[model samples]
Target: KSKFGTDLNEVPREISFCSHTITGNKAHVVPDLSKDSRFVDHPLVVSGPLARFYAGVPLVTADGYGVGAVCVLDTVPREIAPAQLSGLEAIARQIMSHLNSRNLLESERQLSTQLSQSKRQLDDFFDLATDFLGICDINGHFIKISHSFLKVLGYSEREFIYKPFTDLLHPEDVEQTINGFISLESGVQLGLSNRLRAKNGRYVPLSWNLSSNVDGLVYAVARDMTKQYELEKNLIQAKEKAEAAASAKSRFLANMSHEIRTPMNGIIGMTSLLKGSIDDEVNIERLNIIQSSGDTLLELIDDILDFSKLEVDKIEIEKQALSVRETIQDVIGLLGTKASQKDIAVKYIQSKSVPAWILGDVTRFRQILLNLLSNALKFTERGSVEISSDATPTDDGQWTLTFAVKDTGIGISQENIAKLFTAFTQEDASTTRRFGGSGLGLAICKGLCEKMGGRIWVESYLGQGSCFTFTFNALETTASTEGRKKDPFAQIPTDLGSVKPLRILVAEDNRTNQIVISSLLKKVGYTPVLVFNGAEALELLEKECFDVILMDCHMPVLDGFQTSKAILQKFSDNRRPYIIALTASTQKVDIDLCFSSGMDGFLSKPITVNPLFTALDEVYSKIHDQVPSDRPIGIDKNVSLTRKQSKKQD
Candidate 1:
């Protein structure tokens, strides 16, 4: 043996003894390299730690390939023992086997790590998923269930495994669940919606999509529909409650209108009768004040009713031919007296481009103008109030007409202008007190303007003046007014002496209303047969023929609607009198009911002289086939009562 580092032990292949050993699949032993001709002068043999003897065995793999050699060398010449050399070969073979085993073990460890990571990812997905994911067998038994499925059902994994899927369903849903599974068996994908029973005995709605594979396994995903179902149910209930409240409100308004207008009819009617009989100018002025107050009260009631109708979107706009100029002029004329009293000048500026006739609701158009003009006059103490109208043609062959009511009135503040179109709201609390109004006029105008497919707005300074502007769309129409007659009430014929007399009957339940209506009929040159109720009127018709029956609704014994139907049934069309419903109810439904009951015409109360005369004039013209001529007419002497007698009856 020689003392040398491991680097010296590593010899070149040509000089190394082990290199020679690897040439054959066996051991090679040299007793003395100096004696061997092949390696006698080799570097290992001549070097500082010269090896004189050597022994080596080839490291052969199992495949019989000689890769490299294991060897031993010595400085002195020596011979290796045959047993020791055989043992060296055995050790080399063992080393090769160990290396192959280590490589196999390393490959197995890497594969195992990859498999573990994949399984963990799958577990996390199943645990974190919101949807219920599961697998079932052909028999509808749950084979595997995700954590989400177990959590929603409030069940343990053991409780769900191998359990029939239908067992977790609501009793009512079990049949459908089974049917849906059956459908899945036929290769048809199934969508199943049903309720599932939870651990607490509560049913939870679930919507599932399921499909079956060739391996007899059902893959399913489900969503809990509990929250969605609850929201839908709540929305439906809220809608029903809102509708019920609206219906209740409508009924209340109808009843209130009937109750209030019935008495208002009497107050207004009596005031009109009293004004006509008064002789003293001072007394007449007092009557005028009473009449004006009555009219104002009626207007307030109408405003509230109109606002209510608009709030519910119940008011309908009538599209008919109407003169824009005439409507504006009419409003200004009606408010002119008020303007004069307030020391305010009122005027109308009509643009030449403005259409003479357009399709719109005349009554509502007049109402808007009236509200703005009246509001202008009420707020203005001294300055002029002006109404101006202009028109622009739209692409749709319609005119977009803009109307502005400008007044040098107490102007609205910037903040107050926003609240002007809000119902029951004004510039301030003091505004309502100082200027007597319900504050619904502008609000009503806004609603009406929008309903006509237009808008309303205002421009003003706090201390200067206000200009309230509104626009509405209307189509220009060539409607003719050639055959239109003058207002019938403008000059009622005082006498029907030359013409056949109209046998008129008046049915009224209220005593005050009876006196008022009888007096109004007498003033119109007709002596009407006054009856307290519809039944009395019907009884009179049996004995005597009448041309007209002014039937008041809400009468005792039988109502006007019922009486009208009965009268129509009892008499032929030609023999039956023209039935006119005298109703205090101003609701469209009540008015519609009047016509539905076979009444020919409607007269809303408190019945004034003009409307009364107009109704009679229509009747007179229809019966005579011509307008009535001027003739001296007088009330029946028997029916006419003295002022003292009327006061006594009252």
Candidate 2:
């Protein structure tokens, strides 16, 4: 009564009804406190503000403790009702609940203020980061951006926050961003990479490291990659240009080979015929010199062509059944002439260990042997150059044929040996001057060995000599070596003079080539119908029945392809003559084109009498269905068929 709450400040606890109500189970009621002896001596009851009636209720807690009392006092005597007492008890319980709730709310407000301060500091740290940092909501809306984003993209936080993250993505990059977010999962690191639109209207490439899944917030560290992207694009363009240049160089070398070989073919072919006819030893020896010089030139051209092909990755190893013994013998025979000029002992020891036939790239096999032998001859002044072969069978039904070419040559130094196999590099500049070469022979051999699933290496001493060893993987074959090996290395059957004459037609544009071919045909006893171009040849074919036609691939008017197509279309299968291609090109593509254009036989020119007669005999025998009595064609005892004859194939 004296203050806001009803607590008697001066009342003695012994006399106050609240004190009694604290002990009582229900509200302690006194109809007249002044008339009752229980309160007559109380100061509050008999003195100032004396109470005549009093009603009190105990404020008991749920655990049964009476913490306080609720009381009503009246100056006049009154009666307490049960209803009013019960209502007072309910109000006391409600007040205790309100106090408890207020205390809890005050504690919570303090914690919330502390948390807000910490978050504000964290956000400031993110804004100060140098990397492009960002926070996005679970729905992919931009929530916060670092100051670095402003530096990188020229955009303020206010301009991007609350906008969909897709808004800044380049049109082409939107799908990638969407995919990255969709794949995002708890603890899974799915990185994001895309182009974002800058304020300057240019697309800026960015790489992002993101961690967002469980926190319902996307946290990302982004890096500017625009410069990196530009560099990569430039590098790709430079690579393309380099490849194009290499291709152009390869084509140039190929064209040069074709041009050179066309004339050299005539020289070699004529020398071969002259060597065959002359019985005088002196004259034959002179012709052999001319033949050797021509072959050396041809080999130089081959090396150039091979280097170009390898530089541009045009050459590939083709696997087929091959004669292992024949490969060694042929290589030895090929270099015998050069070795004989120096009087070096050239020996080939074929190990009885390897199979007679095996599957491998025969051309590459021969090439590797030839290269090593040539290197040996170039280095050695005298003594022996020896080649040997053996094979080890593997559990996988294959064999590793190992060949070693050991020579008594000026040996290579350890320091210089490593430099030998590098393209266009030799041991020293003097080595190049002493031995005229492209420096591609050993490199080409190494590449060939690798292409055949093997490797090449050398063991040598500074003065003792060098030995080159290489291995090739091959499958064992049951094929007979009889099909490959025969008596002569390079021979025309002298009995070719006995072949029955047949009607022939010749088409050539070059005057010198025309004369040479006609003279050779006359020497063989066949009078050939001659013409200058394909159009004239076609006119002759329409007017007469010819058993065979020697068609030149390239001529002035109506090239061979067009003429052949015209004749094949006009004539029936039975009436059409056997079309044989006579051209200078030795490339496989040119031969393939000839066959595709209806050619039945191919003979590369500066054709010797043997291959020329062999080509004629092949067509003649096939047409007549009878083996000719004179001799067989394409027979070489030492030559590996892996390197098919450049001049003839039926």
Candidate 3:
């Protein structure tokens, strides 16, 4: 508010309202007030009054509360008409109305101030958050943004505001940006994730949520997902690579099994023939050598099969009663010769507290012991190897069996220990050369231990010794099961009666195995009719009957599977011959082929007499009646069975 004035320092009491207030009259209203007696007589008004004639009305709050007044002043006052007074009064009322509006506006202004302060605090909090926050307009321009958005995006406030949201979008996500904004404008609340171009021009994966505010504003929050996305992608690629490698390995194993078994079959076969014909002492010693070679071949096959099972993660454990004392004896019996060869004392630390029979997977438990003992024997030269066990109760009322294998061998160094459990990795490359093994034993043991709800680890010192420890659940065996009879496979032969003579037919493409199989068969009174391949076997079946067909699955012309199928078709109703498929293919599908082609049994190569006999006994009844008087015989080294037997003999 301003006062009307005239000459320098002129003051008046009575002031004109309309003219002074509206036109900002400084001299006219003030000088008029100075001439008036009432105003002139007044001391303050007479003393060069800047306010000559003043008029004002009290301003009121919106709630009718009076706060202050607005006044209009002039320097002079003179006689005035009723119309002018009415005009003055009207102008006074108008001024009062303006004052009331100002009060209401002031109240609103205070409220606005408080709101602005609260919004700033909220903005500060959102800016401090790690997650990105932003506001965009209908035109896709950024209206507001948080500090994190700047930190994560490497942008400043001036750089971000009024900039199109799509300007920061990755080229691949441009369409997605357009779609998202279109959806927001169409009243759609969208939560999306994609890549965005950062200030550094690198694309970063981001996840975000967007919603419309009451004022038609879009609020968005985002999080950087670049690292997480990359990790998941790498994991998927790794999984695929592993699966492919495993598939290739399985195929290679199947092929190797076939290749090894073909030659082994001939060696064992020819040894059988030699046993029936030769009776010299020298021949007997030769027979022992042949049998030992066959055993070695069989052991190699077993290791490969075990490795295959471990590779595919299919080793299953079935719990049953097993004799601890007998298992220890069995391990000692099997590995004793190997230890003796190295002059290593191998023994078990038998505890009196150990139950004679315990419930566990006999096969797996035996395997564990075998792996540990084998490693000890291979690594140790002069010191003793000890296997011991201790039993305790767990918190869950289960028994815990802790087993340890301590060996005083060429101990593992710390460097080797770090990679000990990795497949195909030994203490050193020389370890593989010195100790012949695939280096998969410990890895297989670890996997088996984990599957059985346990863990295995080792402690060793270079040149001192090594101690391998593992824990497993100690299962309780019922008295009836504990005292159960030993399985037939577990029984050692007092005489050769357990070894049965076999009348077999071998269909294979390899020559050495045919000779081996022929000798081995003759020794055991197994009259084997040899065929070079599956096609020849089919032709032979038409003329002579065989007790069992040890049909090699991989062959030229008609495969073993097709021959088996043809044999079944030829005798669909009659007493079908027991067809035992012999192949190196250990894949489940390959094994299934035997069954699908009407095979009565399946024996994977290199076939040991144990599994072969088991299969024969399961399928054939007359196998025991045709025993030959001859003993085990030496295989002919020069005979290659791949040369057709029928033509060569003729």
Best by lDDT: 1
Candidate 3, residues 401-484: lDDT per residue as tens digits? Answer: 778899998899988898998877889988888878888788878877877778899999999889999878866675433332
Q: Using alpha carbons, what is the TM-score of model 1?
A: 0.70
Sequence-dependent TM-score of model 3: 0.61
Off by over 4 Å in 1: 1-119, 137-140, 146-152, 168-179, 182-192, 209-219, 271-288, 477-489, 494-507, 525-579, 592-601, 609-650
RMSD of each: 11.1, 9.6, 11.7
TM-score of each: 0.70, 0.69, 0.61
Give the distance in Å from residue 383's predicted Cα in candidate 1 to where it truly belongs.
2.2
Q: Write the per-residue lDDT of candidate 1 for residues 1-650, one digit (tens) a residue.
A: 22233456355677667767888678888899988999877776676667787787787877888888777777889878778888987877787788679878999999999899988987787788899888888677887778987887899999888988687777888888888887887888899899878888888899999999998899888999999999999999999999899788777877777678778778888777776666789987787777768777777777777888898886778778888887787788767679888889888899999988999988789888888888888888888988999999999999999999999988889988888899988899998888767779999999999998999999998878899999999999976563333332335555642243678899888877888888776765678888988889889989998877888888889889999999878977557777777877666677767766877677777777766666665656555546322221111111111111000000
lDDT of 1 at 180: 84
lDDT of 2 at 148: 81
The TM-score that candidate 2 achieves is 0.69
Writing each residue's lDDT as its tens digit, candidate 2 over 1-650 gives 32333445656677667888888856788999888887788787778676788887777766787777777888889987778988877777786677567867987898899889988987888868877888887567878788888778887778878988788888888887887877665456667788888889888889998777677777888999988888999999999888788767655765676677678877886676676567899998898789878977877777777666666566666667788877777788878888999999988787788899887777678878888998999899989999888899888888888999999988989999888899888878888898877888899898888878889999998888999999988888877533542322134443344565567888878766677677677765668888989999888878897777888888878888778888788876557776777766555555656766766666766666656776787656755656432222232122122111122112
Worst lDDT window (10 residues) for model 3? 641-650
